[model samples]
Target: MTKSVDSTAPVLTSVRQRTGVIELNRPKALNSLNPEMIDIIAKAVKNWEDDDSIDQIVLYTTNPKAFCAGGDVRFARDNILSGDAQLVDDFFAAEYTLNGKLATYKKPLVSIIDGVVMGGGLGISLHGSHRVVTENAFASMPEMAIGYFTDVGVAHAAQRMVGTRGQASPALAKYWAITGYRMYAADMLWSGLATHAVQDAETILDAIVENGADTALKQHSYVPDGEAPLA
Candidate 1:
């Protein structure tokens, strides 16, 4: 049954068979995470987590340029400057809590990233059990560019990821934290940040629902054609 489970105002969401799909829909803001979006996603995930009929959760976006650029920092800045400290506090609290929930989701969580993803977008995708990226996928953690540090538990993945160099080093994670170096799908897959890279990621969501992830991804997964500079 196709049912809208989350906010259609911006964050479009629906249930397709046993899969609960969350689509980042705020293209005007590059799908930046706002309190409302956070609330909707968190609530929907919680609902699906307890729903026995739901077999998995899927996150994707339709924007051609970006999956999610990051959190709505402009909103945070404006609210903080307006002395609405409570609102600012609530936003981060909800967002961070939602991050934790996504990281620990009970069911198979799949993130299909086909475009630019950074900051909060990384939060949404990197924590998932299966991160499928397309050739167009690009990513970074730009918090450092703004005089802030990375959050949403990205440091956990960064420090732990074993690149093709066959070594896991904290220095590598620190380099990304400080430089915000741009990375493509090849770099992501080679670094173990993204689990699978495919020329066509279009089949992932539906295929996983019908054929299961192992069989579905096996059919489409391939080496990214781009150069892995980080490798």
Candidate 2:
């Protein structure tokens, strides 16, 4: 059975063939997550988390230019200027909670990332079980650029990467956190930030649904579709 979540929300959600799909929708704003968007996503994630009918979760962005530019810093900034400390705090509280939920989710979570994925974007995608990227994917934490520390569970991932870098430098994640270096597809894959590099996202989603994640990934990983990923 297919059920559509509220179409009017900033984040769009639906269940299709036992998969819960989330599409980030604020295209004009580059799909940056705001408090309301966070709430909507959290609700859908929670609602589907324990549902036996939903076997997997898929997250992507409708914006072609950006997967997610991260959390809406402009929203926080305006609230800060207005002296709404509580609003700002509430936003982070909810965002982090959603991040944690995905991190610990029992079911498989797959994120097909293309275009700009930064800060909170990485938070949502990287923690998932399958982090799929295309040739167009460009990722960064970039919090240091604005005088803020990079967060949203990135530190947890960085800590795990310390001693286990197979093709990447042991210090790669740490260096990125400090320098906010922008990484393209090859670097993202080698650094272990992205688990798979594919020709397209949509086909991979369909394949996963039909063939299961491990088999579909094995059949499609690192294949060329006119333009192969750098890695």
Candidate 3:
């Protein structure tokens, strides 16, 4: 008897229980992060954090091609092209705040990284307590390629992954830092950026539920998992 919350504007859905799952539903935009989606997710996460019924959360996006390609570049591009300089500033402020909240979330958080997980997407996933990657997973911090500095708390997390100052060195962060290079799941795991490499997501998800691991949840009993194509 899982309770679900669906949002129209932001394209997000939340299935509530002891262990909750949030899905990014806007596949058209490659599940790109936008102001509305950011606000909704931030509010939902805050609400769930205080709800005793929720013990864990799994964050995922609908775009099989991309877990999240990044922020809504078109939005920014529109503003810039229209000479609306303030739009970029506002977007970043809200987005970064959301990222910070995620970084400090109270309960166990899990992210299933299957495809393109770049820029803001990386921030959302990497901060989780358990970050799972599939063979199809690809990740990068490519802000520099677009004439932007890496935000969404990447500076700290990247440094942690690659070591202090080492994250800035060419031998380490250069792929993403300079060229916005995307790394495959195997490489990501080898680089110490991802935790588990799951080959069968469906089986794993079923196990999590059948094992009664989410006793805290009130409604939903199970979540489906499967291979998602790259967006």
Scored by TM-score, the top model is: 1
Q: Give the per-residue lDDT of model 2 (tens digit) for 1-231.
A: 464555656888877787888889888888898988898788888998899998888897877688899999999999999999899999999999989999999999999897999999988888899988887889998999899986998867865642113643536557877888887777776667888888877788788877777788899878323321323
lDDT of all predictions, in order shown? 0.84, 0.82, 0.68
Writing each residue's lDDT as its tens digit, candidate 1 over 1-231 gives 675654557787788878888888898998999998898789889989989988888898868678889889999999989999899889889888888888888988888888889999988888888889888889999998788888888888899887555767788789889899888888887777788887755677678778767778898888856568885
Question: Would you list the clashing residue pairs of candidate 1?
Answer: none
Off by over 4 Å in 1: 5-8, 163-165, 225-227
Tens digit per residue, CA lDDT, model 3, 1-231: 353445545455455446676777777777889888787778778888988877777786655677788899999999989999798889989998888888899987877776788888887888877677666778888788778887777666765674211243334554457667677755565555676666644444444444433331212222213322211
CA RMSD of all predictions: 1.8, 3.1, 6.5
Question: If ranked by lDDT, best first, what sequence of candidates would result?
Answer: 1, 2, 3
TM-score, ranked from best to worst: 1, 2, 3
Q: After superposition, how far is residue 18 of candidate 2 from its true place, in Å?
A: 1.3
What would the C-alpha RMSD of candidate 3 be, to one decimal place? 6.5
